[model samples]
Target chain A: MNSTKGEKIFYGINYFVLLLIGLTCVLPLVHVLAMSFSDKHAIASGAVSLWPVNFDSSGYSALFDETPIFKAFRNSLIITVVGTALNVLFTVLAAYPLSKRYFIGRRFYSLAVVFTMLFTAGLIPNYLLLKSLGLLNSYGALWLPGLVSVWNLMILRSFFEGLPEELEEAARIDGSSEWRLLSQIILPLSGPVIAAISLFYGVTHWNAFMNVLIYINDTNRQNLTVLVQQLIQNQSFMQEMANTQPEMAAKLTPEGVKAAGVIVMTLPMLVLYPFLQKYFVKGAMIGAVKG
Target chain B: MSKALPPPASAITNPSQEQARTRSNWLVRKYGKRVLKQNVPLYLMFLPIMIFFLVFKYYPMTGLVIAFKKYSFLKGIWGSPSAGLHSFQMIFNNDQMIKIIWNTFKLSGLSILIGFPLPIILALLLNEVRKMIFKRFIQTFVYLPHFLNWVIVGGIVVTVFSQNETGVINHVVKWLTGSTFPFLYNETSWTSIFIASGVWKEAGWSAIIYLAALTTIDQSLYEAASIDGANKWQQTIRITIPAIMPTVIIMLILKIGHLMELGFDQVFVLQNDAVSNVAEVISTFMYKIGIQQANFSLATAMGLFESIVGLVLVLTANSIARRFGQGLW
Candidate 1:
């Protein structure tokens, strides 16, 4: 428990390096936040850095105005909520049965699931299958293919396996049905793992961009990430829009608008994160140890 | 409990032993049927998940045959004529194929080289911290970037490294050296930026495992080492590093297994016309030719190639790890 002066210096250097690394991770996002609220002239002149030179809310208001960004945000919310729901439901259902020692064909089913983690039919064939299934251009394309993540399933299964067997046996002896056992006994005791897996699924669903880009041809149905990509690619046009639209010219700058878009898209996860941060860490550790 | 118990031993030796044997045989058959029947509810619950995996996960695997076929919209996957190796031949014959493959490997290799050890180092340094509040704060801050999707991270990368006057890093470089570097445009700077951003995003998240492993190392070993007049550096090199070596090796193998996939999301978001040559990895290339250009067969062939290589690498890595006593399986 005691350290010499040399060890004290080593610990000092360690804290210093870690603090620097941590700042590198956070400072850019902080800069983005400052830019999102900076005045148009301040943004244009590159005066904003870690803080707003001249404070304004125009960029955020511009986002709220009749923009495709808002619609995309709504679509993203819908998909994340529904997709995460299905993900947890399917993973739990499949994991619970497979966790049982006496479940018939458990080995076969477990292998079938684990095989997916090792190989996948690449994007082309997956796209083709979805096209044939009439899921293309639909939200189903976004949600259906990823309904059950094999990694999350394995984590949940490991958690389920760690549960005491005597509870289930006792429930069965009391004439409780399988549904009752799962709903009343197993699930009640599984709050932390469930929360952890749900956070993983929620984050995956929220960040979906490739599926939206590839399968959904309809811009109306596209999510915030796709919209953000379009905004980034069309930076010139966005700047031009600021010049042409008098109201926007008064209120917004292109850089500030882009920063606002980034903030809006990122804010949900950041907001939800602190409350469930421990669960996220727990989920990652579970995946590392078990997966 | 007594009611559920079997009869006493004297009853089993009587003339009813014959009847008891037949009855027990019947009971065995009945028990087997009941066990099978008892599984019905569980099977029903699992039915929907099984159907989902079959349709989405397993069925698309069968569609990999489209790589070997002259796939057409009207003919469908099954009805399409077998092109055999024609599509693969086209892929191999193309000059861009080599460039794409090389790009995938070079980028991924560089990332793994630089990015792989960072988390271990971070975890080691973080382990030295005595203040819980400070450690937790640093952990939270560093882990924040991993939660942001590549789209946002890519945007931050572009913003920070923008060639314009406003770019934060460019401004600093100009201030220091009197000239700005085109970090995202030039091939060299682009690669560096790409790898750096990857490290920034994932290193902390990856460190969680190492930190967890560190906690499992017995505390008494360090105390013993200190008692023997060993310093912190000596203890780390002698005890801490060796303790986490298996985890480090397993993680390295897993990283190597995905060498073909230079993260499509990260590459696609960061890619532009200027850096296309160095940035166009296999996944992005496949997306362009297969999804954007609608060259289904060729794209499928390219995808199959990537998948096969990935499979081989994973199996090879797993075997190697097993030989080293650190295999994932």
Candidate 2:
């Protein structure tokens, strides 16, 4: 074969391998999605295939009907929004100065940040500290601890370093102060890195459950991830198996409901992915390296 | 000291520019004394973050004392009676303590051992594909699981392997051999399920860094190998693997440092009465014995113990990396 045809043959094989890998990643998701929409009887009987059988919106309808789920969703939104805002604000301010090699205390600050990353203060200290601060049973418990991420800070710092000196120099010529230059010049030009970091911060905030579970006891204050865990625990969807057919009330397995719960929480991220897919892979890689 | 901060560029050429920068440097060098005298507004923006870190991040260090105390909320951390070494003894004395430690090491260490190499392999496999559309599609699919909450991952696992007619794995086995296999209900399959689920969720997302590293490799090496009649596998093993070895080692050291936390989210979800003995990691153990039981002192003690062990592992990993000429420091 000629070079082009030979390359074509190789490309075809690569595509086939990649396609199979993609399916391996995707099939499980489809399987769950299919089951979640199926009627409880259809699911319990294993009548469903790769798609929903007897197509029922009962799972979703019942989910929306519950007051706690909606309230939890609201709590999650609040935490994600406020937490991400704080995260972006603190991480950027902290990282900007750290990126400047000429800045005083740079080494000390880097040491402190990296030390925290490598050695987590352990769960007890963190919990006790929060309890002592009277932040227990509060949403502030979630937002405050995660206000600035060392990993994200390092990435933002690297981006700040890569900025052209001439831009800042030009701003300085016009009598712009450091703060002014950062806000007006550096930030405006650093949109990609900012967006990349923001997406990461947002996702982390949205998906966070463990800290909320530890710090907040009030069900009203719990975030979506916590709420979802609660819902799955109650095995509420398993009721569908018992509800429609009394014969299977005892047989109502947790399998389908768990799948539905995973599908429910995972839906938000999966829905958000397509919109932000391009940046995520790039952001992950860029953030992986040190500043 | 009272003079303006000099611009770096003008100082490159103009003597007057050099003079202004010197004046700025002197002002800063004076312990910010001159700058404070000039402007105090700079303090406002940084105050919140400093306080946040101090109160939430650093203040927690005080709780480390509970590790040394017969902790009581009534008497408080300082006033709490000092058992000193007793709680440490309690943990060490527990019949299952060694087993817990061993289980933790097995899960985390083996996860690291197996998990570290797969991403590089996936990335290499991915990089060989020249088609941009196909590459992007595969990446998007893989990265989706990384964003999921562990609660959801656990739920997914249960859904896949639940001992029921509707469970995915059981259904398939029932179809194939006319009998269902109860994967989740069986304790023997729990750890494997945990690790496999972990791999399934993370493999694609984790490959991004390796893919990035692969991009920076010299393409000309591949070209030369191709011309010499070497196939893609040979070029990949000979060239791609060596090129990304630094990133791999650094990532490995990072993974090794985290040899204590087998991801609380993953374990907390997968854990139950049947498999809690095997799956009860340090985090889960703390959550149960300390947090749920509300034994603040004992919890703090266990937390401190875990931290010490984790610290030692990380320090060891860092030092070993240094010895390997691939240390993160």
Candidate 3:
């Protein structure tokens, strides 16, 4: 385990390069975070540097008070919780039977999932379908296509296969049926995989704006991501229309507010990251590496 | 209604235990009962997902007919007349059709080719680092940009590459040479900025998978190669790269499946009228043309075409992977 002079030099160079690359990723976030805290006047005057200069809580206060930003927060929570529930439920149900190597019609069922993954009907068909089902502006629309994420199903399926058959066999011998065995025995051992899928679904649902934009046009049903988008939309449109708060409107920098919204929107997930990441990446790699 | 109209349930409905026995028999006869009866909890677990997909995914899948029809807001889906492929032609005649298709190919292909492999290379380098803390630091830092919102990333890109004299890229250009490079405006440079920014944001996070694959690359092989006097370069080229090749190939095959996707959120936020010609990718185009303009039929046709192409590419890629003995399945 000894390094020669050349090996040591090479190692030193490699570390420096990685350090530089790492800095590049971290620094921009610092810039945005700093900007989010800086006062509107200072931000507009270009006084804000990499760190905030002339710091103020006005932007944060205004964001929380004047806007439906909090309402959006509540909406995002609903969609994420409900959507993640659906995602995990459907993915596990579909994946469980399909994961069984001996399950009848397994290939056909799996092929159906694969078919959905490969070929989508696209926006128009999906939109019309939602309209026909009268799902427009409903919470269900937010979680529809998202339910049964094909990737999650695949990951959970892989996790299920990794479980030893003997565990299920023991339950079967006690007169428990396959359904009970999966629930009481199999699913109990699936904590990590479940956590990982739940996090994945949660993030996707939390970050979802496009589907909401397409399906639910009503402002009342808009989620946080869509609401942030509305802030962006308002900033651009405010000058054209009369500013709601004419006094503050002149000094309002959409740049900082938009930056604040990004932080607000992604911060919850960021906090959730360390807690779930150990499982999320492992679940992902289990499928990515092994498959 | 039956209970209201008929005599109370106390009459004859379920008064007899024999009636209950017959009802149980009927239920058993109607549906083959007790097949994995214990797994009802598992079925219960899947209930929400099944309902959601049934409503959202499968229903939308069946709703694909809107692509083939002149979707009338009044007449509704069933009453609408099918276009007999004319909607596809309307999409083709949009004048910007070729540009949209070209941008999609360029963006997706670039992201797939260079963006795809850089992660593997970075992973290989990091895997060889040997220092645990350093490896973790590299991972934590690089993975961050991937989690960042595209809006923030787009702002950062604009700030650095602003077309103005004080812009960072402009400043660098004026100082080093003599003129400004229109990073956003110039069509030729737009694709590179988009793809490079994409790579910067994702390369580290993406590399995590390759790194995972590398971890499984039997450590004994490396020990054997080192004992034979293989240098770091030789060992990486001969053993490590080959070990991770299957994962790399399988990832490549999957990337092929998403050839038409073009990262809608990223493109939608980053693009502007200045760079519209080059930056107007299919996904963004669909949003504008379909959603914004409300030309439902044309947009649907375009969306349908993209999906078909994507589907065909994925099928072909999966088959090829199957042939080569590698795929996610």
Candidate 4:
């Protein structure tokens, strides 16, 4: 609690450096926000920095009018919601059985699961396998392959294992099935872990990119990540957008539209940012402590 | 994915063994049948997961045989003819492949060199902060980019570093120096931007683990050290660093394990036509060759090589860590 003069200087430098670092992290996003809201002419003239020069919502209006950003948003939502539900379900089913001390061949099963994390089939084989299964170009391609995340399953397994065994014994004495015991007793006590794992899966699904790029052939099926990436990377896509909305071509710039697309794609994360920070730190701590 | 270590194997006596030891039919019927009946639901619960692993994970692993085969789409995985080591031979013979592999190693090595230690330093610095509100604000901002997918981050990077008037940095540079620098277009600058952006994105998120490690440290140790006339610097070096060395080592080992996988999405998004020479890595190369061009055999061979090297690296790193008495297993 006591600070020397040297300690005081160190603290001063520390705060200044940290404040600078924090600003570096946030100022770019702020810049993009400003660019997204700035007039096309102002953005073209490079007048925008951390604040908008001529505040306008026309970039977003143009983005919505010309691009399939709304479709991408809906697809992202479906994948995140449905994928997280399946993730939680499969994670629970697998974790419950593995948690039991008396379960047969549990070590073999756990090792089988964990080994996948160590070395995977990589992209080509996984893609080929998906192709063979007729899962390509469908949302099933996205969800089915990563149905039960090994990491989440491991966390949930530990959580389930840590639950009071007396509850299970008590349920067994009353002729409750293992299913009923898991649903009624184990899950009710695992709200925190489940919530954390859901957020984990939810974020992954929301950010789904490479898989969508590989498996989903239909542009209509693409999620916001891929769609935003298209708008950013593909100059031709911007050209196509301009052609689609020729009336607004003079009023729209690629920079403004791209920045708007970035914001739109990130809007959900921005909304969820507070909850994400709280739970994700908790989730990381749980994994580290129990890992 | 999951970092949860396997729990110590339970040594409960097997009910089947007990049933075998008993000569009486009644005991066998009671113990064996009841055990089987009770566990039926559990086995049932585990069945679908097993199927998923078999079909999606294990089956694809087996399908890696295409790496050694002349794969044909119509002929399928099973119908393809064996090419033995031809695909791997092609990989070694190709100059571009060599460059890509080197690029993968160089990028990842540079990333680890630059990106690895910052989080530890950031964590230590954050630990010294006296103001909770200030600490929270810094953390919130720093962790913001991690929540964003690479697409958004990549878009921001491109926008900020673009060569033209829209680029914020270039605009500032142009005003100051009367010339705009090519941050993304030039190879040297692109590499710098790549590594810097990676640090910017992940350094804060990675610090959380170190902060968590720091929390378990005893305050009395610091109190006693300060009472003994040790300065804050001396306290950190003598007390805090030693305290978190195991964590540092473990994190280092895990990081080394992922040396081969530089992550495709970030590179794919950040890379431009002008800088692809330095930017192309194994994953992106595989995407172009295998997925886009349908050169399945060659791409699979490359993928197989990456996976094997990664597995070897992890094992080697773990073994090295074991010598320091900090095996991940």
Residues B132-237, candidate 4: write the lDDT tens digits: 9999999999988888889998999999998898898899999999999988989999999999989999999999889989999999998899889998889999
Q: Model 4: runs farther than 4 Å from truth?
A: A241-244, B1-37
Native-referenced DockQ of model 3: 0.34
Scored by lDDT, the top model is 4
Residue lDDT tens for model 4, A151-270 = 888888988888888888989999998888988888888888888899989999999999999999899999999988988877785677567767677788889889999999888898
DockQ of 1: 0.66
Regions more than 4 Å wrong, model 2 = A1-14, A236-258, B1-44
Off by over 4 Å in 3: A45-47, A233-251, B1-55, B158-182, B327-329
For model 3, residues B146-196, the per-residue Cα lDDT tens digits are 766665566667655656542445766777888777888877788788988
Taking chain B only, the TM-score of every model is 0.89, 0.85, 0.87, 0.89
Model 1 interface RMSD, one decimal: 1.2
Interface RMSD of each: 1.2, 2.5, 3.1, 1.3
Candidate 1 per-residue C-alpha lDDT over A151-258 given as tens digits, one digit per residue, 9 for 90 to 100: 889898998899888888889899998889989999999899999999988888889988899998888999999988777667664666566777765677667777
Tell me which of candidates 1 and 2 scores higher on DockQ. 1
Candidate 3: residue A52 Cα off by (Å)? 1.1
Can you write out model 2's per-residue Cα lDDT over B1-329, one digit (the tens) per residue?
Answer: 89998788764777887788888888778657644532443344546756777776777877788888887878887898888788778878887866777778888877777777888878877887766887888888888788877887777677767677877678889989999876775667887887888888898888988888888888889889988998866887899888888888888877877788778888887878787677878888888777898777777777777777778877888798789788888
lDDT of 1 by residue, B214-287 (tens): 98999999889988989888999999999999889888888998888778999999999999999999899889
* Candidate 4 docking class: medium
**What's the candidate order when arranged by decreasing TM-score?**
4, 1, 2, 3
- The lDDT of each candidate is 0.88, 0.77, 0.76, 0.90
True contacts kept of each: 0.70, 0.59, 0.50, 0.84
- Using DockQ as the measure, name the better of candidate 2 and candidate 4: 4
